[model samples]
Target: MDVFPDFDGMRGIGNLQSVAGALLMFALIIAVLMLIVCAIVWAIAAGTGNYQIATKSRNGVLVALGAAVLAGAGVTWLNWLIDLGSRL
Candidate 1:
């Protein structure tokens, strides 16, 4: 361990926050790409006249996205419920 630490020349919150914001942007980019790919595959499969096949494929994509959204909401709801119960 060095005796004296260098706190000098430290770039503060702005630099760290920018890096975190960039990571969030990357996550959004990945989500958008996934949505686009899912839509495209669904479209191609849908071109086939097999109604069941297309419906299942579309449903699969919707279910995946819905699960993500619902999972997020569920966590928030569970938190709220915990808070509500604790007050009772």
Candidate 2:
């Protein structure tokens, strides 16, 4: 009994590595854009003495940082899982 599912001839799942790479690239780009926007908002809010807006923008920055970290780690984690599965 094979533990790993046969991926051969699976036309629908075309080029998984390329797909994953593209998705990760997109995620990183989005995260960076979010970070830039958040930084601008925070700066503007602070300059205007709007503490509420500043705080919210700070939170947005954190969320964007978290997303970037997760996206970067996700690929490594997925590779590790695949290696572990193959060893089973």
Candidate 3:
């Protein structure tokens, strides 16, 4: 048996999807911007011999990278889940 979601079974689903997509885009943009800013700051801090700020900026860069990755992976993960569900 095949199982699939009834995307049309509910009202406002299209709007919800649009909103979610917009949010995902916004998040990815912000994450990439933060990553760039953090990397620059990290380089500047390291050059200026500020170990404390360099460490913090490095952490910020890592967090931003994680956020971007998660945001991008969410779509792939969802699609995989839907495909798996449809095959069941």
Q: Say which candidate scores most in TM-score.
A: 3
Ten residues in sequence with the least summed lDDT for candidate 2: 6-15
Stretches > 4 Å off in candidate 2: 1-14, 82-88
Q: What tens digits encode model 3's per-residue C-alpha lDDT throughout 1-88?
A: 9987885566664565667667888888999999999999999999999999999999999999999999888766655655565455
Q: Choose 1 or 2, whichever is better by TM-score.
A: 2
TM-score of each: 0.45, 0.74, 0.76
Write down the RMSD of all candidates, one decimal each.
Answer: 10.8, 3.4, 3.8
Give per-residue lDDT, candidate 2, residue 52: 100
User: What's the CA error at residue 14 for candidate 2, in Å?
Assistant: 7.5
Top lDDT: which candidate number? 3
Candidate 3 error regions (>4 Å): 1-8, 78-88
1-88 in candidate 2: lDDT tens per residue? 7676665545533356567868987998899899999999999999999999999999999999999999888877766765575555
Please give the TM-score that candidate 3 achieves against the real structure. Answer: 0.76
lDDT of each: 0.60, 0.83, 0.85
- Candidate 1, 1-88: lDDT as tens digits: 6685454544454554455556555654555556566677778877866667667667767765665565455545655655564455
